[model samples]
Target: MTNEKKKNTITWIALVLLTILSWKFSESLSGKMGLMVVILASITKFFGVSLQFLELKKAHSFWKFGLLGFLVIFYFLVFLFFS
Candidate 1:
């Protein structure tokens, strides 16, 4: 397979594994631990889909970092408000 296809395959596998792990965490865990694990998985999947599937990897640095900054602020706000 081509290099691009390889990357996609790897990313897809990663996302699947993360999903399953998060699901199990949600089932067996609770409180802050479960929330943190699910949130971490969500953030990883967000970046993976954004960079690979949404073609954000090739985006200008400004736009790329803008998304990162947005996520940071959003999560920060969430933690602040929830905590």
Candidate 2:
């Protein structure tokens, strides 16, 4: 398989795992824990994508970081509003 296809597959798998983990233990986990998870995941994903962009010499690093920031903010707002 091509590198792009492999990367896409890995991304999909990561998303699926995140969704499943959230769905399975969301009730049992405290709001704070959920928020923490979201924050950590966002940061990790941001760094991962940033590194990939740097390694691949992509021109959209800024855009990717902006989206990541937006997601982090959105997640924080949701956590605050719900909790």
Candidate 3:
């Protein structure tokens, strides 16, 4: 297979696995650890989507880092104030 197709297939598999794992965590985990796990999983999936599906991997460094910074700040704020 082509390299690009291979990369996409791997990413898609990872996304599916992460989704299933997150759902399992929802059922088994609890409290702060659970919240952290969920958030990490969500952000991981978000990153994958942004990179692979949203086509952000080729984005300018400024926009890329800016989005990453925003995501970090958002995660901290939500975790800090809400949990």
Q: Each candidate's TM vs. the true structure? A: 0.87, 0.60, 0.89
Q: In candidate 2, what are the lDDT values of residues 1-83, reduced to their tens digit?
A: 99976876786677667666655566567767766775566566555555453442365767666766677788778778877
lDDT of 1 by residue, 27-81 (tens): 9988777777777888899898889878899999999999977996887677666
- Give lDDT: candidate 1, residue 73: 82
Any runs in candidate 3 off by more than 4 Å, and if so which?
none
In the predicted model 1, the residue pairs found to clash are: none
Query: After TM-score superposition, what is the CA distance of residue 43 in candidate 2 from its true location, in Å?
Result: 7.6
Residue-wise C-alpha lDDT for candidate 3, range 15-71, written one tens digit per residue = 999999999997899888888988899889889888877778899988888987799
| Candidate 2, poorest ten consecutive residues by summed lDDT | 50-59
Once fitted onto the true fold, the runs of candidate 2 whose alpha carbons sit more than 4 angstroms away are: 38-59
Which numbered prediction scores highest in TM-score against the true structure? 3
Candidate RMSDs in Å, in order, are 1.4, 4.4, 1.2
Winner of 2 and 3 under lDDT: 3
Candidate 3: pairs in clash: none
Number of residue pairs clashing in candidate 3, backbone atoms closer than 3 angstroms, sequence gap of 3 or more or interchain: 0
lDDT of each: 0.86, 0.64, 0.87
Question: For candidate 3, which ten residues in a row score worst on lDDT?
Answer: 46-55
Candidates by lDDT, descending order: 3, 1, 2
